[model samples]
Target: MTDTERLRRWRLVLGGDDDGTGATLTGDDARMDAALYKLYGSRPGGRGGRRGAGLGDSAPSVARWLGDVRTYFPTPVVRVMQRDAIERLDLTRLLLEPEMLDAVEPDVHLVGTLLSLHRLLPDRARESARAVVARVVADLERRLAQRTRSALGGALDRTARTPRPRRPAEIDWGATIRANLRHYLPEHNTVIPERLVAYGRRQQAIKRDVILAVDQSGSMAASLVYASVFGAVLASLRSLRTSLVVFDTSVVDLTPDLHDPVELLFGARLGGGTDINRAVAYCASLVDRPDDTILVLVSDLYEGGVRDELLQRIARLTASGVTVIALLALSDEGTPAYDTENAAALAALGVPAFACTPDRFPDLMAAAIEHRDLTPFTNHNT
Candidate 1:
């Protein structure tokens, strides 16, 4: 690599520390250094000596620092730095302030923090928090909405196919040809289909019920954001009944807010003890047809509720033909901190438990809707 590239990498690694590395930053690099220093540099003490620095006590100073990071770095890098500030400087409580809320860039992690702090936020700051959550929700919707809709819609269409056709319009030519490809005659060089496959007529009634039972513990903030967005997308389909239920110790049904993910997210209460069995029982009550329901539980499986009851409930759901899935997390942060015992117990009951990224979720849902083996998707991601 070039010397400039090496310097940039070392600058990022060293952060705001000046350890006599014999490297000098100029131009844009110098500006980057200034931004980093604002967040991580040491400050001069009142007695004219050096003191440990931080985000400072002033809200506006932190706000301006937020803006400087955004201006100096790309969106992804800004998100990482913002997350680091929250951790290193203990800035999560400050996020409840309206001015602080306005200054920071919106992302899944930020939304997670806001949701966790929702109950403690003052009335005046609640609106600002909602706005920040809304911005992140809108961005995720723009990026994932179309892909999710297309994947699930295709799955629904595929599942609607039948072997018997009443008219030519209903025939699935591609499926028919593939099903009979082994019957090709060498002389004629053409395949003859002994049976026909046809698309079922569009149903005016609901065909499937999707229940997203999300764990809202403080660690599950990212999963909550992704689940809310997906709930909204699934609810938009005419042939599916979608419901979103968020739980910590208590369960709150946010299905009513599925049309607006922002509102759904705001309705959630993050950070509390988890009760997987209680939440699963509540989700079970929503299932009118166990054979046609998809229950996706997004949690780390750190069950604070009854353990035996949770395992039994999952066993019952699977026995009743309910397609139950346990997602350890739903972000790109890779394998999350999860309870391996609970995960393995669920696996023993014939339910696949794994961590899925946001990009793979649509495909996972489609696979579940079609009752296909989830090992391919799960194994690949895990």
Candidate 2:
């Protein structure tokens, strides 16, 4: 790009007049600058440090700032600014205002903030708050639900597929073609089948049991929001007996509300000291068939309860043939702060401890079900 263009971009980045770019913003750019200044003006370590900040306590002013940000920024950038506004300005009261909620761009972080404030929400603002949350949930389910179902369904079908079909009706033709694709004879226009993929003679009643144990600490807000949505999706799969358990210092079984993630999210009490052992013990008690169960512990492994007991319980779970994995995080935040010692011990016990993105989660679950190598999803390549 030209030097003039570069200076203009840098001028926007460093909002100060004496930022050394000698670039001046006008019209729309000026309005954008004003919107950003209100939020970040007094934030430390910026181009101009700690001058003035916040849009003030007026409802219209906050709502106007929200609208200005949306107009000036893309949806992703708008969401980030909204998140920052809440954190930097302590704008929990903005969420309680219907106009502020209506003007705001809803995202996962926003949903998480709303869920955290679910208890204190006023009766008048609750519907609008829920509508914002529901919109985000619908969007996530639209993007993720089909992919999750498809991946898990394929994995489960493969798990139950037989190599030899007794009759033509029992053969899975599409699967057979896929299995023999590499052995196809182009000259004959046919596949040379080395082994056939077929449907099992009898289907198992319950294919697998999935238990999602989530940590609901204040820092784990985003993870809980994503987990709640996934819990609902997992619950919808009839063959998998899915259970949703949320914990802080105490454990609350939200399996009954798993059908509606919004309700399940409302059930969560977010900010407290973590007790991984107590939560794990409660979830383990619900596991009737260990051999057929996949227990996913979504936590940072900060043990407030007995550490040795938690590790021992996990070891016993893995020993009894239950698949156990500890997700240090399950959000776009990448690797969060977790107890390295606990993670290392869990890894030593043949369980994978890693952070997974929401998009990669379905594949992660599929691999766990089919017993596939999980290294790709872990992103631990050094």
Candidate 3:
């Protein structure tokens, strides 16, 4: 590797500590080092090391450090550092403070932490926490709304096209001509269209039902945020009926709050035993049109309820023409922890189970809505 690349690698490995790596950072790199040191450097009695004294017991110091990290690092790196501060420095309690919430960068993980501490947040801090969550939800909506709407809308248009038509008004001439070019007869010096493709009549609109059955067992926090945001987006469309169901031993339908993802997330009760079977049963009940509904179960598949019943429910959904899919996670974080056996069983039932990143989720939904084979995503888990 080049000298610069080597220095970068060593800087990451040593974190903020001044090791004997003979590499000195400058400019923004130096500023990043200082921010890292503030969070990860040693203090008083301890020797100089990567494990630092943390932000100490002072809320102001912690708040300053939060601002510094956001200023120095990119959003993604800042989010990771924020999570690390919460885990390593025991800053979860401080998050209940208004100043701390005000200073921190809004993200899914931070929202998850706030949701976990919901019952404990004082009245004064509750408003601030909700603001933070609202900001994050708005940012996510801006980033994902258009892409999701376009993909699902396109899928609906494609699915509405019929291959056979009895009337000329229903015929999709462009598609029909494209699909029948192979039947051209050179002897007759003309193109003979053997098959007719048409667009479905635009009458009593066929609204698709989308049920987001998400697992909210503490570990699935990121997935919950993504699912809520997507649910809100789907619910906005007049052509789709969207329902949000979050489960952790119990199921809570947040469909009414789908207009605001922040509210939907706040309604969720995180951290509890998972009951996949019960959740699936509830989602199944919501499906009025089995052929048009897409049931996405976002879970790690660590079944705390009846495992056999869970598999049976999934099998029944798939057999009944409901596009049943299992998402182990819905974050950018690399491969997630999920039950291999459960994933395998879902696969056996013709249901694709895999971890899907938020960016890929829109396309995944498009594929599901269009009834396309999900081998591209499912094969990754296998």
Candidate 4:
């Protein structure tokens, strides 16, 4: 009937724990409440602080109040809750956010929290995380912008490594030069043969490219948040080509809309049937050179379309030399709900499927770049 009542229903629908006595909620009411709670909670209480007494014997009312606010919580309120949860829960400490970040650099949401935590972190630890964040951001942007070179422009490409590009710039100069060396030689009578001479005057164009193909099904919202930030980073790369695709039964190319991560996320329809086959084929069409591209498929591997076709398409891409890595997720959570049968099928095709937090993306990219063998399933390692 009301926004509060609607949110309660949707929460239960989302597999949230609810007492199960509520009025029915239409889609409009649920959306409105979600917006409202995102803006402001129904009841007033900062995270971790105790509510005043007489609320309830078991805090049911308190939870109810929070749920009522959940749908219509304000953006500022939601942000505070996010901040508070990070603080009070001490999730960073428990999850080893700092160390995990060092091992695998995550996106802005994680970086922002760590930045907040940086105040309390030891100097060395904080510095290390910052450095990792800096590198990770740069690397991630490159991955996001797979082929749209010059997005950030000449300043990044022409710049040398001494001072380094900040936030989102990591160009592989040696690789680029070596890749284009044949063109540099004079046609008439030039025999440039020694590794020493080639190394002596090597100035390569360092460019970054990233392609983010995400599944927009219901179970992927948290991972979607990280994906949006990563999209923003990829959009920042001047030398790399970047594109974002969010799919349900249908696929939509959101590459032209990477300016705002929030908008990019809203562009996605979070819950729907999956067509991994169609999504992959669509992404394959976008790839100019599979060898130069890194295709990250963030999905549970469920196929609503033809399953055999999906596996065959993936095998084709891998054979074409595309760096196809399967990520079950990019959330703080270990592994969200996924499709085991689909994962197994793709694994058989040699597609590397793993459940990874955003923190591990940087190392994962590095490994992908080095052409190292990637493990196909996330659960196997654990």
Q: When superposed on Cα atoms, how far off is each prediction in RMSD?
A: 3.2, 2.8, 3.4, 17.6
Q: What would you estimate as the lDDT of candidate 1?
A: 0.87
Off by over 4 Å in 2: 163-167, 174-196, 200-204, 379-382
Candidate 2 TM-score to native = 0.92
Query: Candidates 1 and 2: which is better by TM-score?
Result: 2
Q: In model 4, where do residues sit more than 4 Å from their true spots?
A: 1-208, 376-381
Which should have the higher TM-score, number 2 or number 4? 2
Candidate 2 on 41-159: residue-level lDDT in tens?
Answer: 86677646756677888667788998999898999999888888888888887788888888889898888888888788889889998999899989989988999999988788777
Better of 1 and 4 by TM-score: 1
Clashes of each: 0, 0, 1, 38
Report the number of the highest-TM-score candidate.
Answer: 2
Q: Give the TM-score of candidate 4.
A: 0.51
**Which regions of candidate 1 fall more than 4 Å away from where they truly are?**
1-12, 15-20, 42-50, 182-193
In candidate 3, stretches whose alpha carbon ends up further than 4 angstroms from where it belongs are 1-18, 21-32, 43-52, 163-173, 182-204
lDDT of 3 at 377: 81
Please give, for residues 1-382, the per-residue lDDT of candidate 3 as tens digits: 9988787768755763456566777887887777776666654433244454567786788888888888877888888888888887788999989999999989888998999999899998999999999998999999999999998887777777766676799887888888889988889976677888876646337558889999999999989999999999988877778899999898889999999788788888889899999999999989889999999999999999999988888888888899998999988777998999998898889888889988999999898888888999877644
How far does residue 337 in candidate 3 sit from its true spot (Å)?
0.9
